[model samples]
Target: MRIRVDDLSGEATRSLIAHHLADMRATSPEESCHALDVDALREPAVTFWSAWDGDDLAGIAALKDLGAARGELKSMRVADAHRGRGVGRALLHHVMGAARARGLSTLWLETGTPPAFLAARRLYADEGFTECGPFGDYVNDPFSVFMMRLL
Candidate 1:
């Protein structure tokens, strides 16, 4: 598998991001879901990447600079066909490495609290992420689970 910075104009990357947003909306209804679409991923503070296995887009991940030596993980998703294949883990590791390279001392993320998100929670936990209070523009929302990791 190969993971690299995404241009957001590629069809495979766009489809992956669209699917991720749809899943977020389907899983969390109490809060307004606001995931970056392909166009939105092009923001200056955001860095997006796509993980590919040969020609297939296996997964994608993004990180947004939140200032003050902090960063937020956004739009992490593995293709349905790539689930359980370690694509998510690889993408996560890549993103964390990038964050560290950017001098971010802390990496944070918010995910849904649903059965569909259990694997994601477990992955974060295994990667040394601990539950944390809401950060950045986020507030305490019942539907969201916040996590943070020190780099």
Candidate 2:
């Protein structure tokens, strides 16, 4: 699979991100959902990527520069057609490498704690991420699960 930086403006990319946003909304309550919309991912501080297998989009992920040697993982989603194929893992490593190259000291993320997010939580844990309190603009919340990993 090829994972590359994406501008989040292509038709296919827009469609995929829309699907991602829809899934987040469907999976969690409005107050708990933190998945970014396409417009948000296009902001200057965020660098988005899309993983593809030839002509098929396998997954999407992004990293936000939180400054102070810290980063935030955002918009991580594996497409329905590619969930069990390790696309998420590969994409995750790609983002991690980018963060390290940027000299970030740590990477943080916020994900839901419901059954729908079991796979994501497991992935983060397997990648050496540990539970933590909310960061950035986030506040304390029961439905939110925060994780962090040192780069």
Candidate 3:
């Protein structure tokens, strides 16, 4: 699969991002859902990417610049057809590399705490992210798990 910076305009990318937002809302409370919509992802602070295998979109991920050499991982989603195929891991690494390229030294993320998010949490842990208190504009949230890694 190949990963590239996304403009958030393609139909497939838009559809996948909508589906990701819907899933986040369904699994987590509205107040705790931090997933950004397509418009939000287009903001200057966020850099979005889509992974593709030929004509198929394999996954999506984004890095939100938090300034001070920090970034927040956002909108990570592997297509249903690509689940368990290392798509997520690839996207994660792609975003991490992008962050490092931008001179970011730390990466942060907020994911769900429910069982639906277990695999995601495990993936982050396997990649060396550790649990941490909320950073940025986030406050302590029971439904959210915050993680961080120094690059």
Least well predicted 10-residue stretch by lDDT in candidate 1: 30-39
Candidate No. with top lDDT? 3
Per-residue accuracy of model 2 over 1-151 as CA lDDT, tens digit each = 9999998778888898898888888978898889899889989999999999999989999999998999999999998999989999998899999999999999999999889889999999999999999899999988899999999
Model 2, which residues run further than 4 Å from truth?
Answer: none
In Å, residue 45's CA in model 1 sits off its true spot by 0.3
Show how many residue pairs clash in every candidate, following the order shown: 0, 0, 0
Ranking by lDDT: 3, 2, 1
lDDT of 1: 0.90
Tens-digit lDDT track of model 3 for 31-127: 9999999989999999999999999999999999999999999999998999999999999999999999999999999999999999999999999
TM-score of each: 0.96, 0.97, 0.98
Lowest-sum lDDT 10-residue window in model 2? 7-16
Q: What TM-score does model 3 achieve against the real structure?
A: 0.98
For each candidate, what is the lDDT? 0.90, 0.92, 0.96
Q: Stretches of candidate 1 above 4 Å error?
A: none
Report the number of backbone clashes for model 1.
0
| Lowest-sum lDDT 10-residue window in model 3 | 93-102
